[model samples]
Target: MKKTRYYPFERNRYFYGKLLTVRDFESEQKYFNDKRRLMNRLLHGTGVITGLQVIAVDDKSVSVEMGAAIDALGREIIIPSPVTLKLSMMQGFSNNEYAKNVYLCLAYDEKGKEPVHSVANAAVRSDEISEYNRMLESYKLFIREEAPDPSVFPIESIIEQTSVLYQDGHIRILQRTPRYVNPGQLFDVTFVIEKTLQAAKISFEFELVGQQLQAEHDAKVTFNEPQERQETEYEVTVKLRADSSSRGKATVGIRQDHAVLRIGDKQVSLSSARANEVMIMAGAVDKQWVDDFVNRSLEDSLDSPSDPCIYLARISLLQMGPTYMIEKVDQVPFNEYVYNASALHKLKSKDSSAPATPFSGSITARSSLRKIAGNQEPELNVTFNKDKGELNFDLGLPEVQSGDQVRTGVVEIPIASLNKFAASPFGRGGKSYVSAEIEHGLGRGSLFIYTGIEEINEDYISDILSSSERLYSGSTDVFKGSEHEPSGPDVKIGTVLYPQKGTFRIGVRLQQPTEATQINIRWWAFKKATESGAGSDDTVDISSLEAASGREEQA
Candidate 1:
C-alpha cells in the first residue's frame, strides 16, 4: 500500500519498456516459417537429373552408374552406386520421414532413363548441377570400358559338360563283415579308393559315433602306387567296447587322413579327402536267462547259512543270419559258453556266487511204532557244505507201539540233489519223482512230500499231513522188523513232484510203524526209462561220500 509504488516488474520492463518487442515476435515467426518451407521442399520436391547409364548386366548380377546429389544443407554430395542401388531395392520408403526426404531428392526423370538428382536448386546457392554433369561424363566412360558382351549363350551345350567338369575322386565304404556283432567282439570294415589322381600312403581313423558307443581306432597301410584305372581295397579292424547299454545299430565313420604320395623328391599331398560311414548293430542281452539267474541267485542267497555262493553261469552266443525251422537245436554244454557278469550284477547285486559244485547228498531213513502217541511227529536234521559240495540228512520217525499194527519210515533228501535230478531228465518242464525202498515195516503206511518255491514251513507241513490228498501221496507195504525184501509190494512207492528250477522240499510219511525200518531214497529225474529199466539212479558210493565229507571238513 505504500502508495502502491512497487518497482516495475521484470516482465513489464521487457514487454512494455523495450520498444523492439513487436519486431522480435515478427522475426521469430519468420524463422519458423522458413524452417517449415525447407522441410516441405525436402519431402515433396522433384530434383534435377544430369545423366543415367547402365554399366553391365548378367544372369547373376546387374551394375549401374550414377552422379552426385545436393543434400538438405545445400551441399554437393557424391552418392555411391551401390548405396543408390540398395536404396532403390529397399521397401517401406514412403512411410519413413527421413527416407521419404531422400526419395524426393533422388527423383528420376519422366522417361526413367536419367539418374535422380539433387533437391537443392540455384536459389539455395548449390552448384551440384555442374558437378553432377562432370561426374556423369566420367561414369559413362567407365561403363563403356566395363560393358558385358552381347553374344547369346547355348545353354544346352553348357549343361552337357557340367557333370564331367565337376567329376572328382572320392573314398567309399565297400563292405562291413559280420554286420551284426556281439558287444565284446571286434568289427571289421572295408573301404575302397576310387578314381584317385595319385598313389598315396593312406591312414584310416575309425570311430563309432553315437550316444551309447564312442569308440575310436586308427590304422595305417601302404598302397602300392595305384595303376591308372585300378581301384584298391583297404581293410581296418576296430575293437568295439563291451557294453550292454549299447544295443541296436551304431553309426561307424571311417576318415581318410595323412595321405601323401612321393614322386622322386617331391611329396604330393592328397586333397578332397572324405569319410565313409557304415552301421553296425550290437547284440542284445537275453532277458530270459537274466531273469532266471536273478531269481535263483536271490533264493540261494536267502537259503545260505554263511556267505552267499557265486555260481558261474554260461550264456550261449546267438547265431546270425536266417534260422531254418528244420534246423536241429544244438544242446551245448554249459561250461562252453561265456557269461556277462556286469549285466547280471547290474540287475541285482554282486553278493551272489556261482553254482560250481555237483549236487550230492546221503539220506538216512529210520522208523519205529513203539513210541507214545504224543511222539508221533518225525524229526529231521540237514547239513550242507557248499564249498566242498557235500550234503547229509538224518530223518527219524516215532517208535512203534505194541499191537498198534502200523508201518512207518522216514526218507531224507537234499534239495540241491533233487534240483539237479529234476532239471536233467524232466527237462525243467516235466514232473520229477522220488523212489525209495523200504527194508522193514508193518501194515500199510501213507507217504507225503512238499515242493514249493520257498522252504517248507511247519504250518505247511502240518497242513499236508492233515489233508487226505497230500501235496504228494503214495502207499508202502508193512514188513516184519527183520524182513528185508529186494523188490516187492513192501518196497517204497515213487512219489511225483514238481521241482522249480531244480529246487523243492521233500517229505515222507509212513502210516504204520516198525522198530527195524530202513528206507533207501533216490531221485528219478527223467520221464524216460533208462537202460537199467529204472529212472537214472542218483546214488553215490559210500567211500566217495566219506572222501567228500573229509574234503568238506578240510575246506
Candidate 2:
C-alpha cells in the first residue's frame, strides 16, 4: 500500500561498537543494483539486444533461443539457454476467435525468496506473520493480443508473432530496400523481385505519399496445380499499422526463422526448404540494409536507436475446421526503404510527375558576349502578353539534380540600364550606347531572378510573374524633321532636301578673302525638308567671289 523510492548511499556508517545487521547489507546491495538499472535504461532502450530467435515448432508451439534484453525499467534479462514453449498455454490465448494473431512477448519478473526475519521457518498456520520475504529477479514469457507499446509495458520485447490461420503455404515473398542516403542527394533505382513457381501470376503496386506513409502490399498467391481442397488461392494483403515517428522513409524487418512472403503485388524469392533468416536491415552506401545483413543478425534487430520495431511478416489460413493443408514456402528480400527525396519521389504515382515549366527547359543559347552570330537574336523563349502586359522568358538552363541546388546565374534585366538607353527618334544630344554586361548573353532583356529552384523546378517562372509587368516608353520630339533650311554637325534623315525625280546640283560662290575667311554654320531649318538648300552629300558648283575693280562694276 506504500511506494518508496530508493535514495542510494544512505546506508549507516559502521562504527566499532555499532551492530551490523542484514538490513544494512540489503541496503548496500539495492544502491548498486539500482545504479546499474538506471545505466541500462539510459544506455539501451527496450528490445532484444542479441540472440532471441522464435522458431515455429508446430501449429501450437514455438522455441525461444537464448538472448539478452533491457526492460523499460532498465533491468537486464539474460536467457542462459534456449527453451521451448506452448503458445496456447501463455496468457491471452483462446480457441474462440477464427483469426487469432498473438505476439509472443518476453517479460521480466522476480522470484527467489529472502529471509523472513521476524519468524522461524516453521510457522504453524498458513497465514504466518513475517518481517519480509525479499525476492530474486527472474523473467517470464507471455503473449499479448497486440504488439506492446514501450510506454505502458516494462517489457515488450517480442520473440515472434503467430497467427492461428490455416495457410496452404504455397505463397512466399521477398523484398529489397535502398540502404544509405546520399547525405545531400538521392538517386533512382530499378526495383525488381524474382519469382519461381508453375503457372503463377503476380503484380505489385505501392504508394508512400503525404504525412501518413505506408506501403500497402496486395498479392494473390494461387495454386494452379490441382489440389484436393476447394480453395486454391488466398490474398495476402498486408496493411501496416501507421506510426507517427517515420513519415516519408519506411524501414521494415522480420525474424530469422520466418521467411516473409512480402506483402505486395504477386511476387516471391530464394527457393529452399528454409530460406535465410529475415535480417534485412537498411544501412549501405551503394545501398545499405543488404550487404551488411550477412554480418548482422535478426537477433540484434532491436539494438539500433535510429529505426523502429517494424512489421516483419504475417500469414493467412483458409477455413479453420482443419481440412486444408499448408502448401509450399517461398522467401523474398525487400527493396530498401529510402529516406532521400530522389528515391521517395519515384514511389509516387506515374501521373505525379510535375507539369511542364520553363525551369525544366534546356539552355538553347550559350552564355556569350559577342553579337549573337549573324545578328540573330537569341531565342529568349519569351512571350509577351499584350492584354496583360506580362512577359515570360525561359533562361534555358539545364535541369539540376535534387542535391545540386545552386541555380546561381540568371538572365537579369536591368530596368535602370534599359531606361538609360531608351532613345527618341531624332538625334540631337548624343548617340545611343549599350554595354555588353547588361545587353549580352542571357541578359538580352535582363528580366529575371535566380536563387536556385529550391522550391519549384522550372527554367523560368515568368508565365505567372510577367502578368503584372508593364512597358515603359521615353518622350519623343514631334518637330524633329522641320522644313526650314539649316547647317549643323549632323542632319536628320528626312531633314535633308533631296530631289524626288531627278539629280540636282548646287553652286557655292565665295570671295578670295584678303584676310583669313571664316564661315558660320547654322541649322537653317525652320523647315529644312521643304526649303531646299545646299545640302550635305550633294553635287555643287564651286566658284570664288571676285574682288570688284570699282563699286559701279559690282552693281
Candidate 3:
C-alpha cells in the first residue's frame, strides 16, 4: 500500500523518496523553485565540521575553530567568514501557522527562514527594543583561514560536539535537533555538557520515539557505556554533579555527529483524530393547532377534506447544545408523551409551511430541589392546546437558574406509545403526551424537556416488567389448561398479557430489586442471530408461545 503523507496546508511532495528542503531564506523561495542549484549547494556549498574546539571566550567574542568542506577545485579549504547566527528565544508571530513554519525551517534547515516582523517591533516599551538590538549585535564571527593541509588542525578530528562542565563532579552533555527533519536537510542542534569528564571514544545513539516508528524496519541502537557514550534524538542530555565542574567551558560539535533521520515505515494519515458525541432535546408538537389551521376560513384548500394517505413528516429540531436529553416528564409517562405529543404532532405538521403547533412542552426542574442536590421530584405537564402548549407548575420552592449543574432524570417515551394512542378509540391517533412547564415565583427559571421515541419505549418496557402491583381487573378466563405443566386460564381478572388491542395507563416508581425475582407477564421483542448470536430484530411478538430454551417464565 502507498503511504499517505499529510501537510495541513501544503501538498506533500516526494522526491527520490525523501522530503526536499527549502534552502534559501534570502529570497524566501521553496524547494520546487530550483532543484538542481539546491542539489549543487548540497554537494559542494554544504560543509560539516569534523571537529570543534572552543579556543577562548572574551566579553564580546567567542573564538572557535572548525573543519571545512572541500571546494569545487578538488582542494580542501578552510572557510573564514562570519557565521550569521539568529537566536530566536521567543519570536512573535501573527498565529501558530507562521510560528510553525519558522520553527520547522529554523530547526531542520541549514539556512533557516527569517522572521517577517521582529520581536522588537512588537515591543511595548523602550527597554524591550534596546535589549533586542543588543542581542542582535552579538552575532559570532566565523573566520576561514587557508591552511596548507586539513591534518594540520588538531580540532579537525573532534566534530562540533558541545561539552558542558558543571560545578560538581557530574557532567551533562546535551544535543538538540528538530523533532522532524527531511533528508538532505541539515539538522542544527545544541549540545551542552554539564561538567568536565574525561573520555577517549564517545558515541551517541538516536531514533524516533512512539508508534511513529514501525518495528519491522527500525534500526537498532548499540550503546558503548564503557566508552562514555550516551544518546538522545536530535538532542542528548547527560546529567552531571556539583563539585569541581567545568560545564561553562564545554564546547559543542554541531556537524559531524549528524546522521540521516530515518523511519522504519512511511506513516499514513489518520481518518480523524477525535470523535464527538451529540445530544438533542425537543418540545412536544401540537396537533390541535394544525387542525385549526386546516379549519381556517381564509384558505379552504388548507383544510384536509380527508385524512392524508401517507404522512411524510419533516420535523425541525430545537436544541441548545449538540445533544439534548429529556430530563423530566410530568404526570404522563414517556409512552404517553410520544403517543400524545410527538407522533400526532408530526402527522399534523408534515409540511414546512404548516403553522406552529398550539401545544409544546419544555423541561424544567422542581423548585423545591436545589440544583446539583438529589432528593427532588421533577415534574412535567402539557397544558397547551390548539392556542397554547404549556403547563406551569411550581414545587413551591425557591427559584433556580440555568447552568446549575443539576442532575435530572432522562424521560424516555416510546414509539409504541404512538401506537397505543392510535389504538385508543377516543384518540384520533393524534398526539397523546403531556407537557409540563415549571414556573417559579422568585429565584428559579423554566426549561423545556421532551421525550424521544427511544426513551419512551425503554421506559415503557421497564415499567411493564417491573410493575409489582396489579392495576384494574379487566378480562375473565374462559377456559383452563392441563395441570401437568400448569397451563393458566386464557381470560381472567389480573391475568398477565401482551395487549393486542387495549389502552392501559402505566405508572413508574423506582424500587430496589432483589435476586430470584420473577414475573408472570413476559414482554420480549424479537432479535436476529449473528455469528456470535447477538443482534435484535426489534420485532414485537404478542402470543402465547413457549419460551426459548433456558428462558422460562416465572411466577
Decreasing TM-score order of the candidates:
2, 1, 3
Error of 1 at 376 (Å): 66
Best by TM-score: 2
Per-candidate TM-scores read 0.16, 0.31, 0.13
Least accurate stretch of 10 residues (summed lDDT) in model 3?
99-108
List candidate 2 segments past 4 Å from native. Answer: 1-12, 19-23, 113-134, 149-184, 187-319, 322-555
Task: Select the stronger candidate by TM-score from 1 and 2.
Answer: 2
* Cα error of candidate 1 at position 93, Å: 61
Instruction: Write one digit per residue (lDDT tens) for candidate 2, span 192-256.
Output: 22222222343333322212223222222222322222222333322222343432343433322
Q: Which ranges of candidate 1 are over 4 A from the true structure?
A: 1-179, 194-242, 255-555
| Local lDDT at 480 for model 1 | 36
- Residues 1-555 of candidate 1 have per-residue lDDT tens digits of 001111221222245566676567655654554454344323322121222232223211223344443222212223345422222233322221110011111221111234334564444545334223222311111101011111111111121111110112222223232334344333333333322222233333333333234342334333443222233233333333324445555544333244444433455443433332222333222332344344553233222112111111111111223311111111211111222346556755422354433443322222111112335686655654343233434333443323212223445532222354443322121223343332222212222332211112246754676532222223322323432212211222335433322222334333333222233343323221122232222121132232222122211
Residue 544 lDDT, candidate 2, scale 0-100: 14
lDDT: which candidate is best?
2
Q: Of the candidates numbered 1 and 3, which has the greater lDDT value?
A: 1
RMSD of 1: 38.6
